[model samples]
Target chain A: MKPPKTDSSDFILSVQNLNAWYHTTQVLQEISFDIQRHKVTALIGPSGCGKSTLIRCFNRMNDFIATFKLAGQILLEGQDLYDPAIDPVEVRLRVGMVFQKQNPFPKSIYENVAYGPRISGIRRRHQLDAIVEESLKRAALWDEVKDKLKANAYTLSGGQQQRLCIARTLAVEPEVLLLDEPCSALDPIATAKIEELILKLKDDYTVVIVTHNMQQAARVSDFTAFFYLGELVEFWATDKIFTVPKDPQTEAYITGKFG
Target chain B: MNSTRQIKMRLIRQKWGDQVFQTIAVIGVLIALTTLAALLIDALSDGLPRIDWKFLTSFPSRKPAKAGIFSALVGSLYLITLTALIAVPVGVAAAIYLEEYTSQNSRINRIIEVNIANLAGVPSIIYGLLGLEVFVRAMRLERSLLAGALTLALLILPIIIISAREAIRTVPNSIREAAYALGATRWQTIQDHVLPMAFPGILTGIILSVSRAIGETAPLIAIGALTYVAFLPDGLRSPFTALPIQIYNWVSRPQKGFHTNAAAGIVILLALTLLLNALAIFLRNHYQKKHS
Candidate 1:
């Protein structure tokens, strides 16, 4: 592991010259970005614009697909993640992901939250209990779910399930959290709560979110990246990206000219 | 035509077709049930009186009029155990590999899959021939219990594999992703999440396949399983006769008593199959309720 540079502003992750493909079809092209520590960065784009693909690349989740391939250098705290010596499993632990759909395991609520910690070798009941409680609290779900920790996670509402998934990711104490359209499947109220949770989560974890809701990107993210046709069209402070984007495509998308 | 008249005509036509199809389907179901009921009634009427403990426990005698199915019953049990031991692991493992590890597009995997499907449809006697050549004569095991079990194992292996693959395939992809996201390795995900979720279905399939294996006579007969064994098989190496083989022998005999014994054996076989099927249903329902 490379030590953080003292002279530099802390960037938890940096992507350089990233290109990804599914078989012969290129899905991402030469994408580059920096994720600052303890801040929320939103990737905003239309569907099929590679937002999900970009987020999946952070933890190497694309490896599960048979045709998935990538050429890139992803640096985590100045360490090259794609190095042969670096395990994708270790990378995933450090960079946790919440999916678009609320997929809590069919297990109990406590088991769902404790799954990551358990797999990472935490076995004692008290230790697991603490991790589960702390993670649920961090995700703002503990109070709602505390009494029924033994209940099946699937019994929860969509919003609660999504939060449980978030808690599950948080239990492993990841440094960076990647969420790919986490609010898409949620109701408006659930979306609002999750957006608030995302904003709050940035105080402790570097959070990267992909959202189709432009107002959401403007409301929550400190910085925003706009993508089009698998390329990074523009990246700037959230206020600037919404108000005065340098790229015409970004302006057009935000103004609802075309997605 | 007026719009109302046109709409009425269309509705009548649709209703007529629906009624015709529904009636056809109902008739088909009734026919199947009637056949099953008739067969059960005939078997019971012929076999019920001869189902005394003596008939169930005694061995076949020199007189065709006094034969019993004890040796056959014990032989079937031994054959089932050996077949289960050999077939279950191999079949389920093949299913897991095909469903979880192999890509659908690979030529070699496709070839293997196609061959398995084809093998499932092949006559049971062909498997007996293979077993005869491979496990019995070539390996010099003779017409022993082991040979019969191996033949039955091969006869049922394809069905078990097909059913197990279906079971494993029914597990949601989301569950797999959830495990993977938790930093669980492929093998860990399969062992911890996938297998547990698929187990009830796999068990149901295995039980059904085993029931079919239990009633199989052609493969055993082809493998030269003795029909009139006077003693129970002591080991896999010993000569054996299964329920179907003994039933076949009794039914073939000219005496009325042996024919009655065959019917009694059929009743026992049917009862055992029904028990296994009930267990499968119970397991499936239990798992479904838990998961749901």
Candidate 2:
């Protein structure tokens, strides 16, 4: 098999013939794709289709699972992510993630945002304060939480909490942000707000989002990949995939004929 | 119409069963409370007159009226404090390793977990024997406060580890994942997020175990804690007598006045346990409020 071009300026992440398994059960099969730099790429599939598993692989979040195993390679700007000398912690630093459910630390709002910086050994109060403000502002949550920065993070509304998690991720200054169905727990309004944030974030960070919602993929992503039964059935520009999908399964899924 | 009537009858029977369960539970609570109250009242009635400033300030004597628990009380305090200082850090670190670092499916970890649980159930007297053989004889610490403290520390280490593990497990995996996704190493994740979140629970466990250590008699006696220490322990190596040992010695005497002193010793020991429990509850609530 020919190696995928990594020197291309457009792509920031490349997955080549990746196969993933949880113990004996394979969840992703021979998946290959490139995430465009500074663009949102959405992974859309049904519940068991391995979309979330693929997103987790980008930042090595799946490393925590005892039975998780994978073959093939994931490259970040041509560097092998699974190389023995490269630490998972370093991978996560460059590629941050947000989970499906909102998970702000059980700390004050300001502390929640500053946690990443603190863990990275930043000690000066002034430095942390600036990072907190900037990250929260970028998440579009600064105005709502600024007055009550000391309030517990659990006090925030679901949407605001989700944004706080996003701000927490941004504080580490990652180059790529992988959001695993981040709006699944939110109401329509909250989902819309997060979708808006994702769009704004694409200008600065490469984004890979997994969503069950077809319209969300259409609205936020530049490219969309459709997975079916652990296989990539189609990958194309978001408009073309929705309008004229080459795979019948992809078309059927987007049209709500079946999961 | 017949089926509807049957349904109504079944609902009424179910409600009666619910009431019966509640009544049984209430009866259980009443029985426990009454026994505790009776014991407290009996101890206070017998010992209240003997408890005075002089009683607290004096030492044990052949004359029952002149005897006090001053040395024993101080020794008990020192023992529990030392036991906590030794047991807490060791227990919590062991718990963290078992919970966070090791795979639950591994054979060695499963064996270790089972042994720790078994250790919690092992009799305290057995711990006394171990302490006697190890700290007192082999280590040549003699019948000193340090030996007694080491014995009690071993006695409660299992309980502390069990509770600390439970506390650490309660810190949701989501919080851990959040910490890791920000590039935090495993230790960093534990130090910054996991430990702080589990702090309240760990503290409650530590205090509860320390209180148990304070009331322990068999282990200390088995390790040969002095039954009558007239002078205070000057340091860790000095001979010591805890309240329980002092009480045991007093109760065995034929003199009625000595029995009264025994009751007074029981009262003070009970008070210390209650105070420690109250502190545990307070700190648990305070930290829970702050963390959440």
Candidate 3:
């Protein structure tokens, strides 16, 4: 199979003037950015800065929150994702999410990967096996887990569990992957492995990550957006943003002058 | 030296207070256990001599000397099955809707929740009144097994719902998030992940409710359950008698032999409750082991 053509101009997702609220409190104020195809875009901020909320909006996970509401446009491949006609379920299928904590379903490793496909109407055993293998391999977990595909997911270590979550997301063949502080619950070594996997994953899927660690953003992302108090302070190439940002607040935040 | 001695005396007083409280707690627990043990022992001693195959399988007769609990036992079984079948689904569905689907901010939902909590605390006999009005008279299903089952179902619905909601609430938010992130729809996540995790808890609640329903005679009698059901009920429309009703009837009779028969029936009822409780415990332990 030939790889899909992805250039800088091929933006996979575009968000414009996205305002979000939690009950009466406005949590995200007119956040706007474009996610380029096959590139890693990291959203970095301090805690409670709406970094996670912004990413959750991409796939409409915030719909579950009773008080959560959003305004403005989120377009996937130039189509409005939040349009009334578009199903959040279908949007979630195309744009998969991995949470901060490693949350593998209470099932076997094989079943975890096969879950998405199974729900989406894939029933043939051989096809599901192939998808599971390919997804686990993509997440860099196939070799460690190959012999124990039938083992319970909880038996794996924290890092392995996070990777299993990734593999589970990948099994559905999503075009874009969202990671909400994927390494926040991991140790340094596990964080490094995930960072490495992120670099590799960008070659295939458009990756958007939320992280509190500035170094992680610098290490893995191509583009980085800095958020402060529900506002997007600045967004630019990762190297440029870290070295010489346009905004003074971004500079202070990145330099540890203030949050 | 004087100040130091005073401080020591104060410390001794505090220690004595702590000991008093601890002793009270221990005594309270022992008192409860003793009461329970006495009840069990008394029932066994009184009922053991009367417990025979003939006592179990034979029906009640005009003479207290020849009475048994066959009709009552069969009726209790039927009532329990029907009660479980009706109450479990309605209670679980209400609980899931309240916990997962409905918004907490809505007034109607809040009212429903409050009513359920109040219902759990209401006297069982009060429920009998409601049953008489709704199931027997309003529905016009008087003096039948259906009315009795419906009445029992209403009595236990609140308990099952409250317990089930608690169980569903204890499931971690992370599990739901994991399922949702995988593109599983709300129903799918509930069906595939949440419900399975909550199953053991729901089963436990159902077992407890069913046990309570089995021992209840007031509500059944209020709905006009017959005391002398000589033959087995062929359908839900037939009049029925349960174990508690039989015990009540026997105990009211003016004969020592009838009193002994009632004691025997009480022992059987207690045994049935203990067995159900044991099954609930086993299910909980099995679920914990499998999940952990």
The TM-score obtained for chain B by all candidates, in the order given, is: 0.96, 0.97, 0.95
* List of clashing residue pairs for candidate 2: none
RMSD of each: 2.6, 1.9, 3.3
Model number with the top DockQ:
2
Q: What's the lDDT for residue B28 in model 1?
A: 100
| Tens digits of lDDT, candidate 2, B146-211 | 999889999899999999999999999999999999999999999989999999999999999999
For residues A1-259, could you state the per-residue lDDT of candidate 2 as single tens digits?
A: 2222344557789899999999999999999888889989999999999998999888898988999999999999999898889999999999999999999999899999998899889999999999999999999999998999999999999999999999999999999999999999999999999999999999899999999888999999988999999998888889888999878998999999998
Local distance difference test scores for all models = 0.89, 0.93, 0.91
Q: Highest TM-score, which number? A: 2
Each prediction's TM-score against the native?
Answer: 0.96, 0.97, 0.96
Please write out the lDDT profile of model 1 over residues B1-292, one tens digit for every residue.
5699899999999999999999999999999999999999999999988888888888998675476778988888889989999999999999999888998678888899999999999999899899989889999999999988888888889999999998898888888887787788888889888888888899999999999999998888888998888998888799989999888988888888788888999999998889889999999899877875
After the best TM-score superposition of candidate 2, give how far the Cα of residue B150 lies from its true spot, in angstroms: 0.9
- Model 1 docking category: medium
True contacts kept of 1: 0.51
Interface root-mean-square deviation, candidate 1: 1.1
lDDT of 1 by residue, A103-191 (tens): 88778999888889888898999999999999999999999999999999989999999999999999989899999889889899999
Model 3, B68-138: lDDT tens digits are 99999999999999999999999999999999999867899989989999999888888788889998899
